[model samples]
Target: MRKINYKDITNQQLIDVRTQHDYQAGHLKNSLNLNPGNFKTYATYYLDLNQPVIFIVGSEEEGHLEELSESANELGFNQKNGYLLIDEVPKEDLQTTETILAEDFLNKSDDFILLDVRHPDEITRPAPEKNLVNIPFEDLVNDYQSLDTSKQIFTLCGSGNRSTAAASFLESKGLNPKVIEGGMKAIQEIGK
Candidate 1:
């Protein structure tokens, strides 16, 4: 894989390899957030193999750049252009999404909608019966349009990670999404 620069890839697809939190704080315009953990599943659904895709990785995530690139190739996207160290992109130019903690979220009654992004098998218990939408993260690519776009949505998963990614996607869809920071972990703790 080749190391590339941001200026060169403006016309190409940019996949941000940082965590959802880092991505929400700042990220390149039109770049997709596909952290390596969800790279396989997420990319499989959203990526267009024909269009060249470049990865943008932070120092902490640089180690997985090659792994993601390889996975992209294996998934039939051989045109993976290269990668960009996130440091090269100006922080002021990055975009962001919002996030809220479980504790704070629970206090709100009907102000927001809850989108549980966890897999069905991982759901050992039921989500809150009200104001909740259960759509697994992988299914979001297909089911996103089914979501209620009138209200702010809080994306929840096992940890804050996937929700952040989910929220990023929702944000891209012209919907308002806030990640449930700490995800189900925070909700579980609050329940105890």
Candidate 2:
């Protein structure tokens, strides 16, 4: 487990090991939210083992970093480039990404590209809108080039977890992506 200052971790992939609500409020730019419980599964499926990754936890107390690092190691992510305590980073340095509510997104469906990043099994049931493009989260980094960069992308997932991660990845690639807040779950509730 390596430790580094936030200033030193430049231009590397950052994974935020914090709660979804905390992550949604603010996080380091280009950082992907990977809840501790889901870190191993998501990392194994979507992340590149060879890419250097920096983990940022909400705090240092109570073994948060230890637990997160243990999970990462279990998934074969042996090389942890660095770990940072979130409190050490300045609030101004943290950035929040744009999000569109499910209701608003459904109402103005034609205004943007609805990119569903959920797995095929999750998307088997069709979306209320017909203009959705399915590119599972795991396939996004490699398949993003196939999308039309001119259009604004609104990413969706089962909930907002995967979508937030997908949006961050897209933003890192210089593409603008707005995550749909609450994702398909919110859309379903609105429909109900």
Q: What TM-score, over all chains together, does every model reach?
A: 0.92, 0.85
Per-residue accuracy of model 1 over 1-192 as CA lDDT, tens digit each: 789976776577778889877888898766778889888978877778888888888899888877887888888986757888888888787877877878889888776678998888999756665688889888998999997688788888887877887877777777768888888878888999
Find the candidate with the highest lDDT and give its number. Answer: 1
User: Scored by CA lDDT, what does every candidate get?
Assistant: 0.81, 0.78
lDDT for model 2 comes to: 0.78
**Candidate 1 RMSD computed on C-alpha atoms after optimal superposition onto the true structure:** 1.5
Can you write out model 2's per-residue Cα lDDT over 74-98, one digit (the tens) per residue?
6677565678778889999987778
lDDT of candidate model 1 versus the reference: 0.81
- Per-residue lDDT for 128 in model 2? 58
